[model samples]
Target chain A: MGLAERRRILELQQTILPERERELADICGRAIPYAVDWDTFADDAEALSLLEYSACHRVAMALRVVCRDALGREAVREGLREVAIANVADTSAMALTFEGGVLRLRGAWGQRSAGMFGDAEIGALLSARL
Target chain B: MRILLIALLASTAWYGASRMRGASATRRALRELGHVAVPRRLADREPEERDGLALFAFGRVPGSPQYMGSTTPYAERLVVAAWTPTTRAEAADRALRTVALGVEGLTWEADAGGDAVAVGTGTYEANMARRPAWVLVRDDSARGLTFAYMAWRRDASREAALRTLERVAGSFAPALPTAEYLALARARGGVR
Candidate 1:
């Protein structure tokens, strides 16, 4: 692209990005307070592109923490899947479920990704939510 | 009626006092940031200061190349943000893990440091690439964590990227302690 064109693109990006960050931060902050900082995590085009992907992953992870602390894995998984279905596409192989407020990991993918959340994260989640 | 008026006056005074304190903190932080060079464009938004954690952006002029006659924008454009988590030790532990995960690919590189770099009062990690011109630095201090990432379309030198990162990082000045950041983070109201 030409300089003027690239400059235009950059200008457009500059205008849109901060608004997008604020919107996303607001959405994430609703469920996880400190999650607002996630908006700051992305600094450029590449990072901005990855922002949505990482954010989904982090929110999913935060939900797992919430499940472990509150209802259980299955409920959290079910809740996650519901939210995912409503908001995401093509999550067929994803594994995370809860039964009786207890979390269970099934499938190879599920087992490998287990135990990702910890106390501080959970605290961050609670601090944001509560 | 008189009692109600008195109560309203008291509440208004308290609110005014609280706002004054917040403004004072923000001014102090801005004063501290005097050493940091923030591009005029991004600095226009003003810093979003909550307790000691501040978030803002800085970069080469939106469209101008990093250097004159460069034909293209700086191979590395960065937006830097610094925050001091309310729960310092606890937040730092989690932040360390978060930064580690964030730079997983960089960590695997042969030249990557085996661990974080320890400077006077901070720990830093950098991910650098020679081609495509990208560099990311994640620095942690008693205050909190500062993240700077830059990626360019062309081959940019590591030194250039690091310089931009440092320039932005050096500009952030935190005024509150961890306890204060925590109090702000945990405050009942959310940041707008």
Candidate 2:
């Protein structure tokens, strides 16, 4: 996916959907749960494209696969490692490694203000994925 | 010649005694701030208070240079700072700007629980020298405070520097009781 297209998808996932969910809750006079389906982008290429735009979400999904599907762990790790290697030349780019069921980032992607996802959003995304 | 030698000896003694005093003062101040298992070789300078933050700096002896100079070959330094009335994110940003200055290609990670954040980077000094540095920030939400620990070492592997930082972080204990600190903040009208 192109950068613009990926950004549009992220806008829908991050802003539009949440706003719509909030509107529904307001109309119903109670809280409503909205879940994002990671399987929608099941293809590795498409998922990797989204990973560039929304890393923490993709990482959370990848981590969920690592935790629940023992058979898929190696594949997920390989995919993430590929991503890490591809971005090795970008000094400011975020890098990550998964070992012993722990996820580690190579840089302060979370502290950056450049459309990076936050921890709360990661938790919500993970919950939806699992 | 005899008088000159005696003067030189006296000056050396004074310098050694001052360094010892500074290390002891640093340790006392660190104890007051919180519980940290300071390494025996990590001699410290006196704690400095500036703009509501307490800065405690330490460096290894025998080869460590004085106060983070650029000339030391096998130098190592650790700094522990506490910033109050700030969130973890704010503290992390501030530490990056202040403590991690001149570092390049920094990588950061926050724990799965979101309570701790860490940044690792390398510093380039004179003669194209590179050293590893790690900063770990932990939040105490009850007191609206965040503690940042930074460790850097020249001629040391990244793994070793990170291990030193993690060791200090693992052994730290907060000095103030949560309830007591909260009560004091309330009494002072600092917290609602």
Candidate 3:
């Protein structure tokens, strides 16, 4: 990766990172009523390489939303269980699972057949099901 | 006979000096991780050297099997491991991979001061059974280090296990003149 290529990747990351964070925050805000903290880890190399070539990535991001207090934890847990149960047939870019009381949301943007789960759609699904 | 006696005396002095140097390094490393003093119930076990880090176990819970890189003997174990400077995300990812058997859920916290903590549950791969475990990952980026503390219990109650974990986590005191412990406490929402 030359300076120009590195710059391109950096610029692309700068553009997409905040958007992803906002999208995730919006989804969580609408889904859970409590004060939630977001922790995210992304394998940016693959995402950036794919985005540079085809504007898509197989694994875009993995998010862990932690609800600290007991009430908040319980609320997130119940909401995740309900969403998982209700959306058994739904195939989207995002997958939601509850593990050890934390909510995990993973996104794969390369799967064009399975449409991306926009914040509004996710929020609606969560709000309706939760 | 005189030459042999001198050689023996010199060898003994050299060994003593090297041991002193090793002890000093160990103390400094422990202090860097905010362990001012070893807890009463715990004894320092030989550190395990890995690829780029060292895992230090500092306690032996009664009746627990001896496992390298694991102090997962319920309420009385403190395992601290440190890594070279790295991003919090990378450090955390590596720490979890290195320390825990299998991380189920993680609760991450960070303060403006760049101190971060990841608390989570896992299983302790022990002799008889896989025991429930708690792992705490403390990120000290300023010092170019990441520390992981793990504890596991044989009992069944998760609540009690968590309490014991917190108690053990709180027992570590900060090295003098550094407020890293306070920062960690704040990030963890005063878990102690």
Candidate 4:
């Protein structure tokens, strides 16, 4: 699918999601600007840290399959990877993406918390296949 | 001169020990995800792990690290991550909220025999497009849970990445951790 087409899908999904969910997302979105720069940590364990990070969290992926009119079949891998982090709220993010089958992830972590993605880890995830 | 020489040796020794520990732990991480062989060649040459699975670092140094279990046939997640690249804290919570608006369900976990998929708290429209990531995951029995670890990003070129990630997710099986593996991780402030 193309960018234009994807935008259309996003619009549709936005409509379907419950208002409360949207409200939560909006709340999270709103608090971002208020983030204080106190939860910073050293990124020295770049490699081992990601693994350690991975071990502490749980991720789930969702795909919305699409197809065209043809002899072959097309599947829009529409799903979400609910990333589970070890927290009181059992908080985690979702890895939701599509394009030849790669589900990338964007997440949220609370202030003074250690569940956020590091620079190297984020880059690898972006560069990764899904 | 003697003191300087001893200091240099001590520094070298410290570096070696750290590297050894890092490599061993990363291997165990992959093994925890069920990859048997621990690779040690990311230093000397190319990595010896599976083509689509391994521990990848940005360069020879450490700034941030990512443990990649495997790639799914999905894409837009990466593109989404491109736009709001907040390397610092505070913005992550908002990022997740923004991205979560699109993809909200479907996490994979490890099954006893292999892997299985679970439908969790997804807040998506059946026909919606442009999500953060798409996963074909399974239940992880060993870890006593479903949906282990993952990253979700947002972007403009989302459609392209989505198509690709789906393909990657299809041609593989979900993985679960071993008992010893979970125990080890939990021993170090880690949990399943």
TM-score of the A-chain for all models: 0.27, 0.28, 0.29, 0.22
Alpha-carbon runs more than 4 Å astray in model 1:
A1-130, B1-35, B40-55, B59-131, B153-156
TM-score of each: 0.31, 0.36, 0.31, 0.20
Q: What's the distance in Å from true for residue B65, model 4? A: 23
Every candidate's DockQ is 0.02, 0.01, 0.01, 0.02
Pairs that collide, model 3: none
lDDT of 4 by residue, B1-192 (tens): 999878865664455335434442112123233322222412211211221222211112211112122322121111011011122122223223332334556443333345433212332322322234433223323332222112222211233223333332232222332333233233333211
**lDDT: worst 10-residue window of model 1 chain A:** A81-90
Q: What CA root-mean-square deviation does each model show from the true structure?
A: 23.5, 20.9, 20.2, 24.9
lDDT of 1 by residue, B15-111 (tens): 4333323321111123122224443333223334444354443333223211334232222233333454443334333333332322223332233
In angstroms, the error of model 4 at A60 is 28
DockQ-derived CAPRI band for the predicted complex in model 1: incorrect
Give residue B92's lDDT in candidate 1 (0 to 100): 34
Q: Across residues A1-130, which tens digit of lDDT does each residue of candidate 1 receive?
A: 3454445335425643344334324433322111122222122332323322233333444453455543444333333222211111123533334333223221221121221222245335343433
lDDT of 2 by residue, A7-90 (tens): 645764676445544533343333333343333333333332323224433343334434344444444333222112121212
Please state the error at residue B172 of candidate 3 in Å: 7.9
TM-score of chain B of 3: 0.44
Residue A94 accuracy (lDDT) in model 2: 49
Candidate that would win on TM-score: 2
Model 3, span A8-104: residue lDDT tens = 4465457543443343344344342211111111223332222311111111111122333455345544555321111112344356544543333
